[model samples]
Target: MTSTALPRPPIKGSRTQPIVAGLVTSLVGYTSSFAVVLTGLKAVGASDAQAASGLFALTIAMAICAVGLAWFTKRPITIAWSTPGAALLAGAAAVNFGWSEAVGAFIMTGVLIAATGAIPWLGRLLAAIPVSLAQAMLAGVLLQLCLAPFVALSTIPVYVAPVIVVWLIFLRLSPRWAVPAAMAAALGIAGFAMGQAGTTFLVGELLPTLHVTAPVFSLEAFMAITLPLFVVTMASQNVPGVAVLASFGYKTPWRASMISTGIGSSVAALFGGHAINLAAISAALAAGHEAGEDRSRRWIAAVSSGIFYILLGLASTAITALASASPTGLLEAAAGLALLGTLGAAASSALSDPTSRMSSLVAFLIAGSGLSFAGIGGAFWALLAGLAVRFVIERKRH
Candidate 1:
């Protein structure tokens, strides 16, 4: 007698791995860069409460935008706080603009970002920027942060060595887990240090508080802070972010992403946060094959990341306390480790083409120099220099 063969069981899709990757990616992205945001806010005259509130608001806003956009487009569209813009704010803080004016500048920058999506000419102008120049500028912006690991090693070897060791091992065994492992190492070290000092590692109001700052606009703030912020967010953050998705074969809706981030940034500014934009480095984590084997299901990664971000925002007070308790060099080391891959990718992309080599190098050096002119940051100057060089040199060949 022949026995009838039972039909094969359907394979169930395993979402656990992708979801975990998303959560870890979100946590690393936020923790690695939140220090920069806080420092920038304080530099611009925000009180401790205001700075913490700003972090909470920014995280919540970006979480909403990331989830909404990823669901709408069915793509892993990750949104992030503008780390370069925060760095720009840190530099502009020395210019004496108060927190109110900084908030006003944030509003204006958001308006400009939104306009880029609505206005065809503006969008085209941004899109026309050379890839090499944009990547060079990003490399320049990330250079200082990426050097923090080395500096931390020199300053606090005991705290940094374990972090570096763990990061290196994980990077070799499982590259995706490297940054998270490094972050955990840092937290452990910080906790031990706090214990030695007789201080609590996590002590703060668990609830997030909202603090609204009335924006007061001025030409100085606009020129020095707002315009530069708009330029950098668009060039260094949004442009590369779109490119990252495209590299992973995702057809991103550029206008929609820009508009959503613009609105999110505007809302965040009311509570003292700066611009929110597309995630460049972290986008790869959510959009790549690691998220899921089925491309259509990868949006889940972004959605999960958004959920994690909201939870983090709700715990902003505790996060702020933890950050304050950590050694300065330790936090910097974690951030630096997180960004090492990004720095390498940017450098390679910026110098990839022989034709744009000279112009790209010029942009990189000028942007890395941290020079300022008439309230404008070095990023804008670098772009201008790169464009001028490209025109003069490339035109002659034609």
Candidate 2:
């Protein structure tokens, strides 16, 4: 007897899922961090046009690097703005250096980051940073930003509560869409509030306008802005980004990626953008099973993300204007909600190991204290404090 055979399921193409994943990743990453970037740029004396141009330049540079590197390496290689570096800038915005000096500092930072690839030991030194300390420092840098939502709720409940509630609901229902959903809610609420208040929230030109700032270097700017920015971008962003790729069984081209990011940062600096580097959180979306079942085909996801990033760059003028129109508290709340996951992950990683617990705690405390000395930020001091504790403790044991 012949048995009837069931028809085989139609095969799905490799490109579709990866492309979707890429687009989603780009949207989430840009929405989650662009506000912080705008705030940071303004703190460093960037005008509205300059800040918009900076974002536009950054997006284009990252898009090129992400797409080119992913295609060349045949692996998902996502690039992102240096969130920690931006946070540092927010804190140091009052520094005497003008916007030109900040631009100069950015260029120097790019040169230093690129040089790490040429000087292999520099990359190794960054890798040698203790994981616990690194995590602690990252957690500390993220603490203030993560607290923004609660702060907004306390101060502006009428505007922020709805946004936070929406975020929490979506977070439980669909984790991947949580931040984007929250951002949409915020925009809607803000728009309604503005309308009620009889405010015209005008979006400027849809196309990006270029703003060029000349670099003016000084030792103070270098020590304060350049050094700290370089450290955070490398230690906090690049190292973790590489580790993420490696964890997913991809052979990361560490030196090559660093070099590419350095060049991208330098080019972006001309347009007032800060540093761009390997992405940590968003990289997972493109590199993992979310992109595709087959690892080899996942590079397409990163490429797709890059393409979308360029589109976002083209729309930076409108985005910048929207950000300007929104209540600052509401924007902060959205950013804070988006970073909650990252904060939790960093805290867990920082305190997980018994051997490094004390040191990590010290680092977290010192960094979270927000103390600055000799123009250098707390993040640097936190690293030093943690290493000192580790060193002294290890020496006694020996």
Best by the TM-score measure = 2
Predictions: Cα RMSD each: 3.8, 3.5
- For residues 343-387, could you state the per-residue lDDT of candidate 1 as single tens digits? 787789899998888899998888777777775666667778888
Stretches of candidate 1 exceeding 4 Å from the true structure: 1-9, 14-25, 39-47, 87-96, 200-206, 243-250, 284-297
Model 2, 259-354: lDDT tens per residue? 999999999999999999999889999999899887879999999999999987887887777667777688777777777787798889999988
Judged by lDDT against the true structure, how good is candidate 1?
0.81
